[model samples]
Target: MDGSISTSISSSRSSPLRFSHNPPTPRPLLSPTPRLTPASAGRQPSARLRAISPSPSPSPTTPQQRQQEPMEAFGFDALKETFSVDVAAAEARPLNVPLAAPFTIASSRLEAVSNVAVRVELSSGAVGWGEAPVLPSVTAEDQPAALAAVARACELLVAARSAPLGAVLQDVADALPGHAFASARAGVEMAVIDAVANSIRIPLWRLFGGASNTVTTDITIPIVTPNEAAQLAAKYRGQGFQTLKLKVGKNLNSDIEVLKAIRLVHPDCSFILDANEGYTANQAIEVLDRLNEMGVTPVLFEQPVHRDDWEGLREVSIAAMEKYRVAVAADESCRGLLDAQKIIHGNLAHVINIKLAKLGVLGGLEVIDAARKAGIALMIGGMVETRIAMGFAGHLAAGLGCFSFIDLDTPLLLSEDPVYGGYEGILRENPAHLQFPFVNVLLYSYILQL
Candidate 1:
């Protein structure tokens, strides 16, 4: 896909894809690919892109910068104005789920993640569960603020439950604009989507369009000491994980040491180096240049510079590709469709990380479709969330059938599974044949099926 590269399979196995019946787990492979996943397929290039209207345009510097461009309407605003979800009642509670271990990134070291769990009761008494992982660094929403936002969205959901589902979700968006309590909006959207799917007796992936039944995912290793990273890498590899995400971006030397350690232990594993917006332009260049010197070529280089440093982002991306032929993906710099617009228009990255928390389910679909049409590689990721939210994200990613990378490892990282009922099993497992005796057949099928 242009120079925006992502590894993918041609076609899936001929076996009939079943839904909601858990089968015996399949054999794991060194490659984290499903039997028949057409990952990152169905791209539609040459679709005239509707560029976003990013706020506060920069002062003009050249003739091209001063020229006006056509803006494409993404229908998100219309969807918000027509929301309809009959919510009989809605409830929210503070959730402080302790991680099994501390997850360290460049910005913060966290022993526990605080979130808000929501239960939305539909008029038919079908309750859908959702959780919002609140992080100021990621969603600009703290626990208390996200809880309040969820509370407000519940009120709006109750008021407009009779509207269409999209309209009902749109109403929530209208009530909270400009990324206000984004995680909260995301949680509400997911719960409502799950509730609706359960009511209709279908999997969440089918609710979106039934593109695929399973998704393959990679495990993450947070920034840590070389020994710890190498140990974790080998441990994950032994557990059948093929792809590993190395959280880097502090000092160049330490990062190199950690990577070298992992490589020395498990040289055959696939690796993605995520800098988490911790390095400067020059620093990022030096580190990558050094990586090249050390003979390490990661599958992808993610967010090497600060989020707002768009110029530096492009420079690093270009430098990485030109010097080492490595692909670069954007994470922190891409908040929503608008940021995506700026990135694509400016040629900032090879891949864009799409998190459902930032772009609610509907918007996520639209953005992914747009990115695919634009020929940009796509990655579906999640915050450190439980199985509830990330489960839905995994189904959506699989349903889209065009994601290049899958990073739904948050639940694996969580110390406890506070919520369930979404897709949960090994990457090699075909959950469609799995039996669920506890949940209502319809409820379990809808919630658990792909």
Candidate 2:
């Protein structure tokens, strides 16, 4: 026997008994069974017996207590304890501002930005601002329609009183669904989320992500005569803009002429051709061929075909990359999550441009996450907007730190900036560097949930 027997006392309510390893086989003589005395029957078990017995059930926990466990585990206990959203009032009105020049693109022309401004006030007296930029050719709603939709949505927001950030944003999205009211939804979402950030004393950049405090942006050169394009290129080049996004596809021949003119004045600068869904597959290919013959290869080709022409977009995208090493981006083609998924899975385009006015803030974030997971490139652009909308885009782009192309320079074209406290004036002082004024002390990913 390698092992020795060990004995332990039982804590059960019984008399003490001897424990033996083995007993003799023959014990024929019978012994009378032992009897319990009156004193022993009345005696209680020892303290050792009580120590090993089962414990009583604990008091039931409250629902609030149960909920707090996960919150504490996720490090959101402090945020929840200190901050909450209680919407006090919401308002929307017309926001019109003049442009420095006629901002002409392939699809439309704008001498001024006719948009709607949104203001969301918290019960804590914190206020946030946003803009619904209206481009008649692109967005579904015009200025009047956007204003009305925003006003209606604002009423819904004010009625919400106090609610979860995600729930409020969802209500706004349901009230204003799809591209028909996307701009309005975005404007309302931006204001509410901004107010939430302010209530928590966090900057929008830090709330999004602390990737970087600044983002470099590319300026747009609208469609114009060759001489005018050259002049604008020179002016922007002097202003230290290294990349120029040229609006093309209105006239293929005129487009080529403008490219040549800009090249003559700023040869070292890189180029991004934004056709704005203005070309057939063949015309887009022909333009690339012309540029190749001129020994010029653009860095990116944006929206070369119509939004619905998936096959055409894929063809241009493939040819641009396979032949001339250019990337074709889907601006109009990618308007929502379905469009983003189609582009990602079918390999329709090399990049997807995100405009908050086209896709609401929530929608934009959903697409950003989806595209990042699929390893697709991102570009952030905007319509002709003031600093309100453009500034919000700048913060998002800077915070995410994932966009390959940044075109939030529309505010630069505005003749007058209506909204203050944004990235507008900073870009002019130093076009290459943009720094937001908000100081970020706490960095967390909880804002992504909102």
Tens-digit lDDT track of model 1 for 102-214: 89988777787688777788988777777777767778888988888889888877766387776677777777665656688788877777676666555555444444445
Q: Over 4 Å off in model 2, which ranges?
A: 1-83, 424-431, 439-450
Segments in model 1 whose C-alpha atoms lie over 4 Å from true places: 1-17, 21-84, 427-450
RMSD of each: 11.2, 28.4
lDDT of 2 at 420: 26
